[model samples]
Target: MEFGGMLSLDFYLHQNPDGGALLDWSRRLRIAAGAARGLEYLHKVASPPVIHGCVKPSNILVDVKFCARLCDYGLHFLASQERQGLAGYVDEEYWLNKSGASKECDVFGLGVVLLELLSGRRSDYYQENVINIVQWALPLIKGLKFSELFDTRLAIPFNIEPLVRLARVALACVGNSRPNRPCIAQVATILTNLEMDLY
Candidate 1:
């Protein structure tokens, strides 16, 4: 049960001194893959499907091998078609309506978290007018300019293929058309394929 780390995923990602060593590009890809897998398990593998409701870097813990295990299920709730409203974590579409939350909401929040990990900044902390992390990264992602948004602290020497794929996945998750967003299982499968290709 002991994952051999610090208090929370946010702490591990941001506050830990050893974080730099584990937060490199390769490890980031792996952690992203693990997160996709976790979401896959929740949405497809589990009965009755669980919606995390909040998916942020701080909620994701890194293990000894740098594999990620999603934590802070404390905010997780059963998927519903009637409930609505969660802070920074809720999907944009759900914000305007009283309709319930779903797995897609988690997917949107995960996209924001992914961008935060890549950019090395807090989701809410903005440099300019870009209030949210995803909003700022969207243009760079769509234009395929990896360097524009990637963490400059780390030297990324590998072919940026995986990062591009992950970006696409994130975009799909935060799609303006909510119904067009892929399910968690679909997203996980795509990530798994990307991971396999990296080997």
Candidate 2:
């Protein structure tokens, strides 16, 4: 129930002692894989299953080894508060309906977090030329320009295949249709495979 060396993935993604990305391509893949496995446990292995309403980088905790432990998995049990505007990481359906967030919403949030890991940008903000990280990176990914989609603070990955595969998985999770989205279990398997293939 307790863990040490707890730090948000947001910190590792956006902050560094040397003023660069704390995680490079390999570390990013490792963390992303770990996160997917944890989510798979919640969505499939746990009895009765569970939904992590918040799946952004800020909610993903990392240990010294950068193993990801998703936090706030139980927040859905708390009563809903008075209405506020949508959070940037929330799925569009959840924001529009003011309804309960489901596993699919969590999928959407995870996609955004993956996008952040790749781009070193927050999901909530729109850059001047691009609407958001998803929009900004999708074209770059599709165009096979891995260098452009990667975090500029880090050297471009020597092997870009894993990053490319990971980006495709992220995109599969981000769409508006819940039914069309890949389940967390599938996403987990894909990420885990990508991790194994890296080494």
Candidate 3:
């Protein structure tokens, strides 16, 4: 598989080459759905079940067609040792349990990525404040302030049902406790349906 002109999802999270948002609502949904499917495959279809260790924007590469490809999967052992950039991506249970990375951790990371995809804000900081994406988005998502959660770069779509559903999925992945978090398979299913609805 060659990502000749592929760019990391992080590239789209910020300003595009044209100084405008490259990811509109539809493209964002497609990327999210594709990324979910990739992770679901790794966790369920892959023999022995692989843990992504770190699931962040930079690890998800988007091709010219906006196809998401999950990279650096099953690197928990090395990533857990470094623990440098894994700050906001990994779940709290990972540090508390000391059992190493798990599927739940990956879900939490994807939730963060989804939040970043929704809002143009980075995981490291929101606006000028040093708040994690989950911390910043949870309240807005809970309050049903869907408008505020959308990235300002993209005009809010008239039919917001899909975006709302995606937000709920992100909330489930990050806001819920590890035991309560939906597995990647379930997330992929929801996102797949949402993507299909876009047509």
The residue-by-residue lDDT of candidate 1 on 49-160, one tens digit each, is 7767677777777787777788765354454544332455567676575654568777887777677667776666424564766677888888888898887777765687
Name the lDDT of candidate 3.
0.87
The C-alpha local distance difference test score for the whole of candidate 2 amounts to 0.78
Off by over 4 Å in 1: 1-3, 74-86, 125-130
Top-lDDT candidate index: 3
Q: Give the TM-score of candidate 1.
A: 0.83
- Provide backbone clash counts, one per model: 1, 0, 0
Q: lDDT of each prediction vs. the true structure?
A: 0.71, 0.78, 0.87
User: Candidate 3 residues 1-199, lDDT tens each?
Assistant: 6969888888777646642267888888999999999999999999999999889988999999988999988978875454577878888888887776899999999999889888878887423557778998999999999889998878998999999999999999999889999999999999999999999
Cα TM-score of candidate 3: 0.94
TM-score (C-alpha, index-matched) for candidate 2? 0.88
Sort the predicted structures by TM-score, highest score first: 3, 2, 1
Please give each candidate's TM-score.
Answer: 0.83, 0.88, 0.94
Weakest 10 consecutive residues of candidate 3 by summed lDDT: 12-21
Off by over 4 Å in 2: 17-21, 77-86, 126-130
Every model: Cα RMSD to truth:
3.6, 2.6, 1.9
